[model samples]
Target: MSMINTEVSDFSVQAYVDDTFKEITKAQLLGKWNVFFFYPADFTFVCPTELEDLQDHYEQLKEIGCEIYAISCDTEYVHKAWHDHSEAIAKVTYPMIGDPTHQLARAFQVLIEADGVAERGTFIIDPDGKIVSYEVSSGSVGRNAEELLRKVEACQFVRKHGSEVCPANWKPGSKTLRPGIDLVGKL
Candidate 1:
């Protein structure tokens, strides 16, 4: 089933952040934009690069009032270890959530039960806790954080201006199309 437009399920999990461990919950995500980034595991190929890429854009995402949460099936201890060892991961300021029981991965529908890992899943959730956009990709394929930021901008734009819609490759300050009878079949 499609997860788009669905409210995030109730969950409370431990997360490693800023050299300490803290608890995070669905309720905490309410009233702010959030990015739930799910990866397979820690200490693997391709994951660090993707995480660093996200770190590069973390400030921009925060400027737009979005908090990023990087999740994996690994435990919080593992997350901290990776952060300590990996320079790429060490630069990350966002929360790294530990889903040891796979509850989060299962809720996001990215769990690989056989392998006990999660697929690459990125979910953009609105302040109301409803998922507005999501992308699920294979484990081997890495995602671009810049593109995710663009989509968030578009989603925010459409939310504020209900009548207009962003077109393909739409960026901030770009023209948006408004659906109307006169514009039908014109494009």
Candidate 2:
């Protein structure tokens, strides 16, 4: 069940942002690059390290017009508590979404029903509210913010230059392959 290019459904959830609770809806995800970082839980090992790394790159991501949301099955209250207690989580300035009812987790297909948690899922969505890219991994493994940023940049570049396609490890200035029109559907 690949969710690629699937338009996000309309829904709203409470998010902890900048010392306050806010509602984040599908409408908010429109007209900009967005990243949905789904982790297992708050105050857990590995998750904090990943969140801190993401916080380190938050400014650069925003500079490129991308918004990030850290989501888990925890409640907004728990998210705030974690932010207040954990030094790593303390540095996060992006929206931290609480999906205790698993609405988001289920929609993202990252839910672990038995454990009442989510897998480590990272999704890159375009302004159209469609998922352009996604990756899921074991809870023990952490993701790299630098790589995620690169992917977002690449997605943006491709969106702007529809004829160009990014290659592996592609950066902004890197060369991209422009498939010949005759060869477009062969692969």
Candidate 3:
């Protein structure tokens, strides 16, 4: 089933963030854009690269009113340990959510039940708590943060301008397609 426009369900999970441990809930995600980034496991090869990539662009995402949450099936302690041990992970400043119970993973439909991990998934949710866009990649592949930033920018632009739609490879300040007006001549 398509996850588009699906409201995020109520959930509270432990997260390691800002050099501390805290509880993050669905309620907190409301009133702001959120990126629920799920990875296979903590301390893995590709996961850190992706997280670090996101970290590099973290400020840009926040400047546009978006918050990123990196999640994995590993426990919070493991996440903290990885943060303490790895140089790449040490640079991540966003919330590292611990989905040990697989509640969040199952809700997002990215859980790998057989392996006890989540697929590499990226979900962009609006301030209303509904998912606007999502993508799941193969376990062996890593994603690009620059692309994720572009996706968030596009989502925000569409949310602010309901009548317009972003075209392929759309970036901020670029021309957008107005379905009724722009398509009148073009087919």
What lDDT would candidate 1 get against the real structure?
0.96
Regions more than 4 Å wrong, model 1: 185-187
Provide C-alpha RMSD values for all models, in order: 1.1, 2.3, 0.7
Q: What is the TM-score of each candidate against the true structure?
A: 0.97, 0.96, 0.98
- Evaluate candidate 2 by giving its C-alpha RMSD to the native, one decimal: 2.3
Instruction: Give the alpha carbon lDDT tens digit for every residue of 1-187 in model 1.
Output: 8988999999999999999999999999999999999999999989999999999999999999999999999999999999999989999999999999999999889999999999999999999999999999999999999999999999999999999999999999998998894399887
After aligning candidate 2 to the native by TM-score, how far in Å is the CA of 115 from where it should be?
0.4
lDDT of 3 by residue, 18-63 (tens): 8899999999999999999999998889999999999999999999
**Two-way TM-score contest, 1 vs 3, winner:** 3
Model 1 weakest 10-residue run by lDDT = 178-187
Our tally of clashes for model 2 stands at 0
Clashes found in each candidate (C-alpha, N, C closer than 3 A): 0, 0, 0
Query: Which stretches of model 3 miss by more than 4 angstroms?
Result: none
Model 1 clash pairs are: none
Better of 1 and 2 by lDDT: 2
- TM-score winner between 1 and 2, please give it: 1
Evaluated at residue 97, the lDDT of candidate 3 is: 97
lDDT of each: 0.96, 0.96, 0.96
Task: Give the best candidate by TM-score.
Answer: 3
Q: How many backbone clashes are present in model 3?
A: 0
